[model samples]
Target: MPEPHQLAADADRAAVVTRLDESLADGRLTLAEYEDRSTRAHGARTYGELAELTTDLPRPAAPATPAAPGPSPVARAVYGGAWHGAWGNDLRAAWTSWLVTGVIVTGIWLVSMLGSGDLVYPWPVWVVGPWGVVLLARTLGERRSRGDRQLPA
Candidate 1:
């Protein structure tokens, strides 16, 4: 498990982002305003502050998809929970699917770049998304192999 500080930070980020989403949906904030706020929200320092910001915000739709397999740590971490409730497993499956997809996407991007074409993704997306996939793949695999001992059967 990661340090509590990091988990708290991730939760804070998720909350702040949700607040940004609510602000964008309401006419009280414009796209540009939302963008500016989003930039700041991503840099938020504490869950307390994020809780404050989202106090008046409408509830956001959960990113969890319970019909699937367990959620990867990235899913849990990004979605502001230890596990994504019933959908955690499904989200983990989705992450695995994305990992395979990311490899294909990167391969195509590489081929395109080699042929004097452009990558479908920005350089950072290729780097970050795949790294996340790989990390989550390992994390979820470890969790799954540990069996229902840790998670609900």
Candidate 2:
């Protein structure tokens, strides 16, 4: 698993940008400086990079304790903890359901096709397609909402 500090997400960038905006409004930074730092903050790919953008200003969020830089095998060995953390908190459940539903539906479809000795209309698609579309929409909506919230990194 990647170290916690190794990557920054959209929410992190948004938070730094908010802090930069605050600084600009309060006369701590000029327009050009704010613009430059805002761009850099959005582009930052790690916590350290984001932290640097607001180092001179009052923190907009809790101080990001630099997560341990090394990939700690011990940290990852903690079963559900690292597994959930590996792909953000929500991915494990979504991915697990995707896999399980796919396999079960495929299995049932195969049995139906073989039992009738014919591949007529692929009916399993009815179940799988709608489920997949709904899941995709939910995933995308969650990301969009999270980006909008930008509560913290």
Candidate 3:
């Protein structure tokens, strides 16, 4: 875990603001208080400052959607440590596959054209397109299952 005085990232600031919003909705904080704290949260440069704003409030509930690469409840419960984005690594592997397959397909197409001295059918698309589609479908399904149906990168 980072020291509270360390610089806060956008995600950290966003999380603190979200807590303020929830506190407002629950009547734990007045609109004036929420606005004041939210403004300070946006301007805050360190985790220590953000923590001061929420120290009195209960921790917010976990969002249903899978969060961005960071802490996870299950990881903390089991391993007592923050997550290291192991789940997101799958997408990286998928992208790597796309890059490798695209290069191979393009190379094949170039070789075919050079040998035949004519632009024949772009046969590479046949090899790569369906594979890409399958990967996309699989990624979407997995994300949907996790309640994170946003577009994959």
Candidate 4:
């Protein structure tokens, strides 16, 4: 480890500022104290100076067990582990839009059919189907890529 007197980088100062912010949020520091510490943190020139600003704060607790190296529980439960991380979040939003669009289009089709007093060919399927296929393909591709990264047991 570098000596405490070593020059602090901007990231080092920023990290101390973040800790001070957390302390303020948790009510460990009054606004006045937080402002003082935050200003000091930003102006700190060495590791020792930065460290002094947060020495009174408790350290973050370590997880009891190492976090499982995989997708989050919500993703696993909802997506069967095919979707995760940032890309998975994007996939979820896309699917949500698709579902909403499908519902709206299907509703319009139903209303039009009722007005005509005759069965009309369902056209909403054309709007929903191809988009669904593409989303499914992307999901499967994500799953396959995740599988590829696993070590053989």
1 or 3, which is superior by TM-score?
Answer: 3
Could you tell me the lDDT of residue 68 within candidate 1?
43
Tell me, by TM-score, which candidate is best.
4
Per-model TM against the reference: 0.29, 0.36, 0.40, 0.48
Full-model lDDT for every candidate: 0.61, 0.71, 0.77, 0.83
RMSD of each candidate relative to the true structure: 19.7, 18.3, 14.6, 8.7
Better of 2 and 3 by TM-score: 3
Residue 114 of model 4 has an lDDT of 100
Q: 1-153 in candidate 3: lDDT tens per residue?
A: 679989999999999899898899999999999999999999999989999999999976677997555434564466333122335555546757887989988998899899999988888888889988987776665545655322322
Report clash pairs, candidate 1. Answer: 66-87, 68-90, 69-89, 69-90, 70-88, 70-89, 70-90, 71-88, 71-89
Residues 1-153 of candidate 2 have per-residue lDDT tens digits of 235478988988897898888899999999999999999987889988887787889756576688544324543354212322324555547667877888898898899889999986777688678877876776665555544332222
TM-score ranking from best candidate downward: 4, 3, 2, 1
Off by over 4 Å in 4: 1-71, 78-80, 85-89, 148-153
